[model samples]
Target: MIGLTGSPYGSSFPYAREGSFYLSGYKGAAIWFAPVPLFDHSGVVSTFRQLELTKTKFGSIIKLHLLSLALLIVFSFIFYALIWKLAPIPSGAYPFVEKMWPLQATMETIWIKSTLPGGADVVGRLIRWEYISAGMVFTTLLYGGLMVLKAPPLLFYGLIAGLGTGAWIHYTLPTFIGAMLGKFYFSKKYGEKRWRAYAPVILAGYGCGLGLIGMAAVSLVLIAKSTSQILF
Candidate 1:
């Protein structure tokens, strides 16, 4: 049995014990393991110290990224509120629109539909729309927040990297997979319907546009970082 032990004052696990272990080291200063020697004690301690340093650096990076994300979320929320409040009101049949509609339109499919389909559908649609809208709003807000937050250049670059990752994983790949699935599953069912036949093409085009936007945003962010550094 290999047992792990951590430093009381540090985050690193510096000691490992085997079955029937009973060992001692410098009191309150170093850790000890007994019964089986899996590694050199001094070497293990050094390695643990290096790992601790690395972990500290990584933690700093994560904290910076999270700060940027939060800033983006707040900015996005404010932007959404402003847009919703300043936009024109719909007349007659259209109901009062909320601040989250733009985000919902981009992320939620049910909200894309014009007429209500059936029972409890409105409630379900609203819930999904709110959840997705919140996510989109959060991501978009973070993109702008990084600049205002005075984050490190690397942090801004990381945000762009994350956006690129999201565009490919969330938008482009899904669009491709959705198109393939539609062709495989619905081609036979709706082959004669012109709208159905063209749906995939339209979706693919939308995905391409979104992907291009994401790429442009990434390039702009990188360029801004470089220019700022050069000017300063």
Candidate 2:
């Protein structure tokens, strides 16, 4: 829904984040920028939605919204049905759809957050049920307003990164900075085209490495839990 509303190609990192299922690390990269959002701050709603709210295409938006909702319900039913048929988990436990699921925006989908070893329920069922998004709404308004004021993208990006760090939302900004430095260093030494060609491969490999590291983390967590259980 996010990618459908915001983008069709899933080219931007934000778009890919909105639609992570499309850009699995081993397969490919699609990181292109669109200029439309700079001018038209339509936010996450479908074009139909924009039209409806603005009194341009009300019925169509309602139809489209209902259609999208129906498809989602159907797809969800089919997915769970298949899971029950093929690889059923024990009663009351959900399977971990690991790897890239964590990298996605929480607003985009409902996900189960489970702690390894302890199997604690960090997020049960839907992370959110309502369509009303206070945080996204605020950020969208803030961003649109800032853009009107001629705010530099990187300036606000850095500010958000700093604030996110303070709020314990780590990982993305550091990697983004590291990638920028790597780009500069390599582009300066080699050619821009050469670095551009190799950058995707390097990052893809790094992503796989991170996955392995996550597995190691799971192992360590289990070991620590077991040791603690034994000791105390």
Candidate 3:
């Protein structure tokens, strides 16, 4: 709406077209950052998400925040339990947990600061069902493995989560660069008067091109898989 990433609702300058819902702009902004780690990364993004949450219905906002807090508590407990069970972590447990507590508390503070109105029905509807399903499956498998088999916690986090973190950064970097380049080029060419109007167009073009390429890639992969199965 305003950059490579969509702008928030009622955003200033080239104001985004109003959607049917009040949070439509906020939803766009959230989805724009969906590729990145939700809990980690830039404070700016975290702050933005908090702002976006404010567009949700008051009741639904409270519920979503509570749900997030509960999940965090459960994850913290699980991680601590795993640490307790680990062969070599007994001595380091206190220091590790102590160090992590501040971060956890800060996240809680951010979550609590958020407020919303008129967003109950759409609270969880923004995210795609497939993403929710996949997240559930992944969480179940990871926890099941850790609890049942006692897989090393570091191994799970380091390999899988680490890769995911890297992938999201990689996916987001190009778009960010494109937006910056657009800003520079537009400002230089159009001068102070008109640059802002065209900068966002560059970001839109990048997203559209990437979307087409991604779809084509997925289509090819599906076709190849089908053909291989038929041939073999």
After TM-score superposition, the amount by which residue 174's alpha carbon in candidate 3 deviates from its true location, in angstroms, is: 5.2
Q: Which residue segments of model 2 deviate by more than 4 Å?
A: 1-176, 223-232
Of the two candidates 1 and 2, the one with more favorable TM-score, higher being better, is 2
C-alpha lDDT of candidate 2 relative to the true structure = 0.53
lDDT of 3 by residue, 1-232 (tens): 1231132211222112222223343532343223433231333565567667777455775798899999999988975565455435324435656677778776433332222333343434544779859976986788677868877554454334334543477755774576576568756778856767665576599899999999898557545533523454
What is the number of residue pairs that collide in model 2?
A: 0
Better of 1 and 3 by TM-score: 3
> Model 2 — which ten-residue stretch has the worst lDDT?
25-34
Worst 10 residues of 3 by lDDT: 9-18
Per residue, candidate 2 scores C-alpha lDDT tens digits across 1-232 of: 1243222322223333323432232222222222223333445456656576788766776798899999999988975675555433542223354533454545222211232223333333324535337656866787788899997655455545444443344665676677688777888887889888888798799999999999898657545533523455
Candidate 3 backbone collisions, by pair: 57-117, 57-118, 57-119
lDDT of each: 0.51, 0.53, 0.53
Measured by TM-score, the strongest candidate is 2
The TM-scores, one per candidate, come to 0.20, 0.30, 0.26
Q: Residue 35 of candidate 1: its Cα lDDT?
A: 34
Q: Output the better candidate (1/2) by lDDT.
A: 2
Model 1: per-residue Cα lDDT at residue 112: 22
Compared with the true structure, model 3 gives a TM-score of 0.26
Question: Residue 135 deviation, candidate 3, in Å?
Answer: 29
